[model samples]
Target: MILANNLTKTYGNQIAVDQLNLDIPQGQFFGLIGPNGSGKTTSIHMLSTLLQATSGSITINGLDVTAHPQQVRRDIGLVFQESALDRMLSIEENLYFCAGLHGINKSAIKTRINSLLDLFELQSKKRASVGSLSGGMRRAVDIIRGVLHSPKVLFLDEPTVGLDLPSRRRIWRFIRNLIDDHKLTVVLTTHYLEEAAPCDNVAFIKLGKLVSEGSPEELIEQLGKTIVEVSGSNAEDYIKTLKLSAEDYMLDGRTLLIRVHKPQPNQVEQIQATLRDSADIISVRKSNLNDVFIWLSSKGQGTS
Candidate 1:
């Protein structure tokens, strides 16, 4: 239940976000992806009413973010890139503090704390200092604290950036479960491609512009043909011979991605015949959202 129309933000000469238009439905898991300086964070800040937009407009749950900041805050929960938990406080104390901040009464605070602790699996660690918890545990606590008020919309920025694989998976499962159980609306920002796979819809941004927005499958379908990745010697020669676009070049480890318009009639066989003894076909697979991202960001700018 979030909408943005031609959202733009600038700091002096640098335009952090430009003409971004987003429409996210209720109970949908939306993803915002881009490179380091692609303005994803700026967009989130504007949406959260933490930073004022330079132009354009935003509304959440039918209230204008700028004109009705307090109303928007009442309906949305935000989990930042950095952990905002109080390291000195115990897990229960931290959530209790957040609940109080949201004007939750003392009588309901205890119930909310217990429920959140159980949902986030922090019940046993309730009395433990936040500093004593691992990064993943801290992340879970951070998210729980943000949602202590049981907000309608959730904004998560890089939720699992630095955690180990298990921790990352834990958060993923937790998020998925929360969405299903609570019917929550989520707007998650991340650069990790694998992380984007589970999202209901994805928005790709680059150079302060939104390049594409759709389901991952819808975007991948736009990039025709199966992708054949070959590795080892003579990749450059094969690329040149095929006249592959410079933008198509992907230095993914040792493999080179070759995108053909029509991958039929034994396309892999012809590649095997062409490369012959020069190179080896490391992997052959259909196109994916990653491929679509590379192609779109490299070719030119796009719109929703």
Candidate 2:
């Protein structure tokens, strides 16, 4: 239950977000993705009432964000890309400070903190200093701080940026459980495309504008059912022999990606056999979110 209409943000003569519009339904796992400086964060800041939009309208749960920022803040949680915890403080202490800021009752704060720590399996580390924890643990604590007050919507900006694969998966598991248990709406922005594949809907932004929006599966389907990638010094030359249309392929340096719609097992076999000698590497697999992102980014900026 969030709506933004004609949202715009500018810095002097340069525009950071331009006439952006979005309508996120309740309990939806929505994703906002773009390259660096594509205005994803600027849009999030304006929507969260941390920064004001130059000209636009935003409403959360029927209240205008700009007109009623205080009320809006109470309905949302934010976990920034960077850590927001006080490193010197114990994990429990950092959560306590956040709960107080959100005005949770003194009596209920301890119970809330303990429940969250248990959920993330951080109960034993509650007494540990934040700086002493591993990167993954600190990030988990940051999320615990954000949702301590149980806000209806959670905004996560690059929540899994630097974590290892296992840690990232663990964080997503926690987030998924939170959403399922509490009916929380999550709005996420991440550079890791594969991590976003589970989102109900995702929007791509470029040059401060909406480039494309759809379910991850729907977007990837636009690429094709299968992706064939060939890489080597001769890859580009070899791709020309396939006689594929320009729209069916993308070339990035030594690698060439070709979209094969509804390819049969035999078709894949034939393609691989043809490239066996000419290419150093050849792979044929199901298309994925990264393929969709690369194709979209390539079309927008003339590069991948």
Candidate 3:
């Protein structure tokens, strides 16, 4: 379990994370999402004890983070957005060095490494240099390094950023197996909203403040049942022609997203007819996590 109370970090006049509070239960997958400058990384660093907070308090497993940083580090694993494995070393060597840092015995480290490598189907590449592996393979090795010591909480900061669809799915399957088998608490931050859809709980932040927190379904439910995506020129003009309220739609430069709480028959037909000549594309779809993200991001300074 983890708890953060009024957590805040400031750089003189600029506040990176302001009054952030989180209560993440054990064995839960929690997501912290926002736009480019939304301070997600700052919050993660403070929670992980890598960066100190200006004010407020954080505790993990009933121990104060600031007061027991050494013990806290022992109980947590962090895989950064960047690769942490040394390019020159073999996968086995990288994991060996990391396990040794945690005071793991040589025999135990070898056994543990073997089991994890086998689980990920990387047993054959144990002796291969990290630099020789593909991006996805290297990322798998990084993940192995993070959990090699069997930490309680794992922080995955964009763990599947640039991987292809297949690679991303493979990585997630491995992550799910680990969480299910070990009951590991996972804290994730990623640009991909679809990935956050599987999380147990998710929180959206903007301008260093918490905007909303709930299950993916709960957040998406706030928007209506169906969403009409209208891709056309001068989208603002279409909204006026449609005679919709301000809250019923979101207008981007050339795309207009209209939220329909109650689906009336022929609504899409009517819109198509109205914009048959002006619109380039028109489609009706269900509300999703991306819509929730847009709804939140539109409130503040950024959009991811």
Candidate 4:
């Protein structure tokens, strides 16, 4: 569990995070999303006790992060964006070393390592050097090392930022399974729209302020639109023709977004038939998380 009230962080004149309040319940997968340099990492650092909040309170499992930093560290496992693995060490060796650092007994360390190797499907690569592992394998090992002590909260900063599609999906599965099996509360910061869209809750950060927070569905329902965007050469003129009913339309540059008043029989056919007069319609697609982000960013005062 994590609770932060008006958490603020300042680096001289630049405010990295400001009055960010968040509550992540036990076993919940929470996502912190924002564009580049939007204070996501700064917020995570404060919540994980890596950085001190300038003017707010953070409590993890009933203990204040600033007052009991050591205890907070014990309760949280942090996996940063950059790989922190010892490339020279073997997969098992790295986990073993991390366990030992956490004061786990040698007997228990071996058992824990074995368990993680099995769970992460790294048993066959136990003896393989970290540098020799694939990107996904190395990332998996990094995560295992972070959770070696079975911390209650997991802080993952851009967990799947640079991985290929397969590797990213694999990590997503691993993260979801870990939370479900261990009942771990996760605080994740990522820019990937797909990644954040699946989280139990999402908090949007912009220029250090907490701009928006809600479940993906709640956000979509609140700010997103059922966008029917038709691409064609006459997008502008077609939009003007639809302008008499302008209250139901939105234009983002070249995209013509029309809100459906209600479902009509053969709606797709009618919409296309209307567009056939002026333009050769190319595509029509539904709205997604990116649309929600766009709407929130447009209304929020904070910078991306």
Candidate 5:
């Protein structure tokens, strides 16, 4: 449902996004993730028709984003970090106002609002003022408002930021349900890597360039199957002396993360026993996308 080829964005001599190439199919949940100032937002904005690209072309649902922006906008939904609803307005009122702005049929507005409110399990609270709802509910309402028009593509940029783990999980359940029911294609960007662990595909942005893109499973597998986390007060000293046959490793402050190439039985146990005296905390678990992210960032210019 989305296509971006060599999409470039710049400010004078500073390139914000460099030759980004993506092909996100319909109904796919795709993630654009990276450290701060890595152009994830810029890439999404260009895809959503909010910002124009400096070079190359983009198409959303086969509509040229630059040439047919108005039509493209009709097929896209965007929910950013900030709440789009008025704090004082009732949830029902807020959704109605947004639906009207989207030019949704007046005949279908109330039905749509009711259906979405029910789906998010906020029907009883629909009459309550938005300000009175919890943060999670408010974010849910934001997602509802974005989909009020039933846009084919949704752009979520840090939509769950600042929410606690439970709240984030709740919001994700809502999003996944929406995708399942409506086949809504999602383009999400968030600092919470675990939240994106279930994405159909993910693209990693680094230094405003595409460093890696693949399914989360593929990324984790490519990095390694086993990850060793070593922490101690004398972490620097431990890092200097540590020796292990591994694909790669990264040091984060006092935490040393090691990715073992192909873990063998009892490998973690032996490693832990070997480091028992030197480290304060040593543990091992299956590698995940977070490991891949840290590995990628370490190989690039330090993330901002």
Candidate 6:
């Protein structure tokens, strides 16, 4: 339900986002990923109407975001990387305050607040001050506030940045349930690569340009089926002896990562035997989104 055409954003002479085009369908879990300073946040800010684009157009549910920003704001919710909650307010009070801002009916606000609290399992702590809650609990409250208005689209930027693994998983589970139950369209940008694996589609941004866009599976398939990582002082020499081409491997200091396309039984044993003597560490595992991201980002620097 979100579309952008030739979107661009700039600051002084530096372009933060350059000619990005995106089409996110309704109920889709879309992800925007890239390294730091790649303009992921700038793109989100423009799409969410927090920052104006330098050129091109963006639409949310067919309404032009730039031309009709106030109207577009009604259709989307944003959960920023930083917490937006008031530490001094009680959890219930925070919800009540946000409900007032959304113009919810006075009588209905209480019931809605209770329902959300129950869903997030924060009902027992409704009266506790936000400052008294743990980091995970506070982040959960931030999410609750963002969706309190029941907007059709939700924009989450680094939603799980500082949380522990369990908290991160809990947050994602809540997001998934929100999408399934409410048919919510989610646009996410995160540093954690594993989190993007569940996305319906993901786009990589670099140097303010769109480098690649595809399903997680499609992107990973481009790098082959498995990644064999060998680390040792003689790793480069070992790879050279194997006659592996530059395209088939990546050199990261002491570690050499080799892509093995559809590795056969004999090939696996052969690779192990070859590395056993020279490598200090050898690991063979399924390729993942992180590998695709690294390959694309490094490769895109010269081309994009």
**Deviating ranges (above 4 Å) for candidate 5:** 127-132, 243-247, 262-277, 301-304
Instruction: Give the per-residue Cα lDDT of candidate 1 at 15.
Output: 94
lDDT of 2 by residue, 1-304 (tens): 8899999999999999999999998899999998899999999999899999999999998899988998998999999878989999999888888878887866888887888788778999999999999988899899888888888899999998778998788789888987889889999999998878999999899989998888988777766778888898986677677766677788988988887764445766777888888889988889888888877777663221
Q: Which pairs, if any, clash in model 2?
A: none
lDDT of 1 by residue, 178-283 (tens): 7899888999997678888888999989988988888887767656546788897777787775566665556566678876555358766787677777777656
In terms of lDDT, model 2 sits at 0.86
- What do the candidate models score in CA lDDT, each in turn? 0.83, 0.86, 0.88, 0.80, 0.85, 0.88
What would the per-residue lDDT of candidate 3 be over residues 182-229, giving only the tens digit for each residue?
Answer: 889999999999999999999999989998888988777766657888
Candidate 5, residues 192-281: lDDT per residue as tens digits?
Answer: 898789899999998789988889988777787788899888766765565543236677888888776654677577768878998989
How many angstroms is residue 294 displaced in model 4 relative to the true structure, after the best TM-score fit?
3.1
RMSD of 4: 3.7
In candidate 1 the C-alpha lDDT for residue 178 amounts to 72
Clashes of each: 0, 0, 0, 0, 0, 0
Candidate 4: clashing pairs of residues: none
What C-alpha lDDT does candidate 4 achieve relative to the native structure? Answer: 0.80
Residue 21 error, candidate 6, Å? 0.5
What's model 4's lDDT at 18? Answer: 83
lDDT of 4 by residue, 200-281 (tens): 9998888988787889887766553365677677677876665525444556766676644344466556667778767655
Error of 2 at 113 (Å): 0.4
**Residue 48 C-alpha lDDT in model 4:** 88
